[model samples]
Target: MQSNRGTPLTPSQAASPHAAAVADSSVTRSASQQALILAGVCIAVLVLPLNFGGAAVSAPTIGTALRGSPVAINWILNAFMLSFGSSLMVAGALADLLGRKRVFAVGVALFAATSLGISAAPSLVWVDFLRALQGIAAALVLAGSSAALAQEFDGHGRARAFSMLGTTFGVGLALGPLLAGFLTQTFGWRSFFLADAAIGLTGFALGVPKLRESYDPHANGLDWPGAISFTAALTLFTFGLLQGPESGWSSPLIVALFVGAAVMAIAFVWIEGRVTRPMLDLSLFRYPRFVGVQVLPLATAFCYVTLLLVLPTRFIGIEGHTAIGAGLMMVSLSAPMLFVPLTAAHLTRWMSAGVISAIGLVIAAIGMLWFSGIGFDASATVLAIPLFVIGVGAGLPWGLMDGLSVSVVPKERAGMATGIFSTTRVAGEGMTLAVASAILAVLTRLRLADALPGSPDASAHAVTEAAQRVATGDLAHAAAFLPALGQPVLVHAYDGAFRVLLHMLVAITLASAIMVLGFLGRTPSPTSRDPASPTLS
Candidate 1:
């Protein structure tokens, strides 16, 4: 009305104040939208790792339902990890080249659909296949989601955001077994998949409209050769590991897989050097700090996976705990992770990143050693101290390592960086499971042979195979199959196998501590602009 009526109002005269108001409203709206997107991303991240720990507890149940052997049950976990780890770098490249939001949405949708497929699967084969597909979807989601977050945040904002992510990760891991036990016992193993599907669908719906798009304009072309070779190398290596103990370490098939893995690994290295736009920047390894940080995740995953497999098995098989009770016991191992990350910064006042990380590894190793000292009849109460210590050690370096690993790289390559980091973590998990399982199986068989000397070779083998079920905490089902007289022998053999596992874990964790002390360089502060001297804080 004023513009129309009076004084032939100048262009700025009528619009300046209104423009400022509109701009303020837009800024506020954008911030709100960012908040929504962050919430969605955190939700997705929490759910993904939850599946890892939850499936650890539920694998025996799934194996029973599908009439799967222990080897086949291993594949249930491996199939997902193999596909997920293999495809992460490729998915990251795709996110950089295409759009993060688009890829993330697609991933969420695929995950939702695949969850339904897994829930309805008729056979173990179908379940494995579906799990593989879900892994692919997970790769996409993880790459896109993290990249998107990196793009939107910077400085203190980024630190806080990633810290929150770390906390959420711990929460998911901590609660996963409890949720899995409750759901599986009340409804069925299928209920977890159904819940996963529902969560995925919710994320998908929220992502499509709420999440903004991001892409790296300078990203290079996709590296198909690198992708193929890397995938082949990892798959072959994992296959060899999985088959080594089951088929005999000297088996032709296992030997061939190992050879194939070596060849594929060489090819991958060759391809990465030649590619114009390499999926992985080989130069990143030039920095000892980066290399050390990358390996830290692997070490963390190794310890975590070991406990994830061992604790539940011990609780259920030896202590005669229900699934829920076993899960409750795991709380001592996982709960500390929730609170320790927030206080990790306090350690910076007295120690450098490398020293802190090395100390953490040493502490974790001590925990493993302590836990291993307990006898077969030890109670959960006796186990709590070491479990809590291990959890604290893991939590201390969780967010710090992740933040430091990616800090050396420019923001533009966050997708690739995140992918590589994630690959190492999951691959460490898969490799540990494959190798540890092989060791456990071989040793368990040998222990069974020793325990039941007069039994027929076939009889011992049969019972040993059944003992694998008992060792993994499926005591109820395994007891149904074995004779009463042999039950004690089976349990004894299983306990001995667990001891072997614990010893191996002690050595592995010690090695990790040694590596951190030897290789991890000092990282610079956030205020530091020096490229040559990087510090983790």
Candidate 2:
């Protein structure tokens, strides 16, 4: 038999079922090379938001272009996250049960098609719908690619593969805003989605001829019930969280959504326990190291998303910087990500995964502490130091954590484990954004009351808007407030926001550090599997 790359099966391999099976099912060298290439192609899908985040200074223009209402504009950005977070586990399991190569190819095709649809969308509703579809494609690619790489490589080779994947993912995420800012500034928001479609199509054309499928012949059935329940729980929970502030948190609808989400989540656990083929094996938590690996990523994700949300608001709104300036400031957040994966791989040679993770969390906490001290008057250069420190801490843990997660699980279960890990990380990222926004809102209102002498309600509204504008540094609007309340009120509000953001970071990071160090014992060698490993199967 010949592989997709036209490599002939060797005679000795043909003589043995296992060898033939491995050769037939395993990735070709060309396929492995293409895996990294495909990963880059898939990353283009994320560029839309990165561009939008910085360019949303022109949200009114974007809204007009898409013919969307204000609420629709928000959905255009959030729909992707909602679908991406909800579908990740199902995509991973499907890829494992079916074939990684096949699912990835399908995802690429779907993503390309949806990107084009978004480009041509006549209304915001259609654009949002297409974006949701694009998220499903992204989920499939992300979940399948990681699992495929895990199956294709072992030992040092696996570490390098993961490092490369993590590095590419980080780079894509960082570059998205930069590219988006430039493109939106020059071309328009439509260019972002168009470029993504073009890139996805190009990658698919180059990869389809060479990519290989990786799936265990002995893999269990897909956990439809688990996938459905998990998706429902996440969707309802995220919706409630996002809507809580706008719709009163005390609203009956909000209350029902939260309760429904909680009930579904409990039911998901019960269903997973009884199912022979669980989407996420509950038993993975049994091993302290495995639990630590999972928790560490969640922590890192929380910090990363929180920073992404808060920093731009602080830099552009409060400091009177331009959109470009705000995007550039994130260089501190993103530049370190490029080098961290390689650095993490190197560190893994000297230290255990647990120690590396713990150290990273501690450093991140310190960075958060330093960031808390930043006032309205702080210089851009001064801010970069702590931002870069947090980036470094964020970068160091992922490669090691991913390597450790797969190392402990049997090869056959790699897809399921990888899927679950991705789901948690994505959920953490989304949840953190919502949580951080709520915190900032509350603090802004409180600070306004303390800073102003007018009617508390009037002052709170004015201060909240001023604080938001200051956080984004929309100097034109923020400057208007300086005359009414003067710089002192703006300064006080900004200080209050920074303090609250810092506290949140410190609390989350400290809690994560404690969880890792206390729960995750010394890392065992890759070959050792705790007989007491906590897996649902």
Candidate 3:
């Protein structure tokens, strides 16, 4: 009776039911608030991946409608990715210093606004501008929302919450192509943007009010120098690659870009080493398992994400498949993303994650080789086998990598581990895609030159333009530029150029697999979890 005030009482110890009833009400209220917070963040997360997968499928349609150069069309995708990838670490740092909820709400609002703006864009330039802005907003939304979600749960609850978040991202990627294809095929490309805009607005309304504000007490101020240097470095590097095929690789402009890129990269490394709370925690790279964790995403970028754009272009641009038909075929490539992760999670019962990842990559390499032999005459069912195999192979490591990201490092370093992994995963995709695009364009240009009619009518200028057009998935317009060779010859040239790129991807992917296996061989599995530490499974 002297100290019952702060204690939860048994039924017999309670003087009246009123006190117990009040305590029960407080518990109920706390549970209700948690549900609201989870709902808001998950809804916002869905639209970001949706754009990645959706926009890839819509490329051919967007190209035809927007009437831009192959370079210009390529910019549409790279512009978004570059801004998003380069901005993520900075955005995360800012979220920690300011408030997670504040950044998250603003991000959602800006994302919604940009989506709406892209929907009504009159030209590719407008779309490109808005898409880059959308990417920055996307980084803010992702960084803040995930951190906020982590703050609300602990241990098993935290793992489960993040698992749900991962699955939501999976669902978006799984459904993006099909949904975008349907909308584009039925109405127009603009409809896809409009649909995403509606989804973004709904997320904003649901999440903004329920989200609680929080900040990292230990976070130092933002690293402005590191952010600027890193962004500039990547921008210069990507520009050099993209413009190399058009402007002679030895051109003064191209050389300057490359040199600038190298200088900025060195500056970024210097800045990170000196910063109190660095944008990149360079110390983590010293660990072999942590290094391997980084390799996994770069491998996937080459094998899986790069194909999302390439396959859609081949199906709709060159082979004349309808958007709906291409979308249906893409199900073979992307649908495994939805379920294979679950299957791979169970495989850990028999094998190490590294073994499983390496084996998966080997399988993808084989599938890519098989795809190199496929031609336009092959039936859809026959075509899908290689693509499906690639999908399953990629899915195995995809499931395990998220957990490995945090678990590979010590508990105190988990946040930094996650930031590095997320940045690598995203930035890897952008840089890889840009490089792949350059190779495809450059190779296609050479092949087209060889296939040219060797008459005065077929000039080198014409060959370059046609090849650029073809690289961007515009076989019809590309064919128009080189009428002497006929469309058949142009298509064949494109096919030959493409097979070489596929072989290159196969080699790089297998090499990365070996690196991951060697590096992750000795790292131990996490045995115990702290209830207060944030993590994902």
Model 3: lDDT to the true structure? 0.77
lDDT of 3 by residue, 113-168 (tens): 99899889999889888988988998888877766665556556666776677777
TM-score of 2: 0.79
Please give each candidate's TM-score: 0.87, 0.79, 0.91
Local distance difference test, each candidate: 0.67, 0.60, 0.77
Q: Give the TM-score comparing model 1 with the true structure, all chains together.
A: 0.87
lDDT minimum window of 10 residues, candidate 1 = 14-23
The candidate that achieves the highest TM-score relative to the unseen native structure: 3
Q: Which model scores highest in lDDT?
A: 3
For model 3, name the residue pairs that clash. Answer: none
Give the distance in Å from residue 400's predicted Cα in candidate 2 to where it truly belongs.
1.3
Per residue, candidate 2 scores C-alpha lDDT tens digits across 1-537 of: 222222221111111112112224443566456465545433533433343343333333355455443235545545666677777767755665577667777887887788788777888788778877877887776655544444455555555555454555566656655665566557876776778778777767765545556653544566688878887887788777656544657889899999999999999999988977666678767765566767876788666656765565555445656545666777777677666755766666677666777778788888888888876677778988998888888766654555566565565444345445556666666666656655665566467556666645644445555544444334345446545677667656766876877787788887897887765547753332211111100
Candidate 3's C-alpha runs over 4 A off are 1-33, 455-458, 526-537
lDDT of 1 by residue, 1-537 (tens): 011111111111111111110011122336677677677777765567677777766776787688766666777788888888787777766665677777777888888888899889888888888888988888787766755655555455655665566566778778888887778777988888888888777766655576656655455467788888988998898888766655667779999999999999899888878866676667667767667777777777666666875566567655666668777778888787777655665665666666677777778878877887887677778888888888888666664665555564554333345446666776667777777777777777777656555867667546656655665555655566556436676677777887778777777777887887676646642122111110111
| The 10-residue segment with the lowest total lDDT in model 2 | 11-20
Q: Give Cα distance to truth, residue 88, candidate 3, Å.
A: 0.9
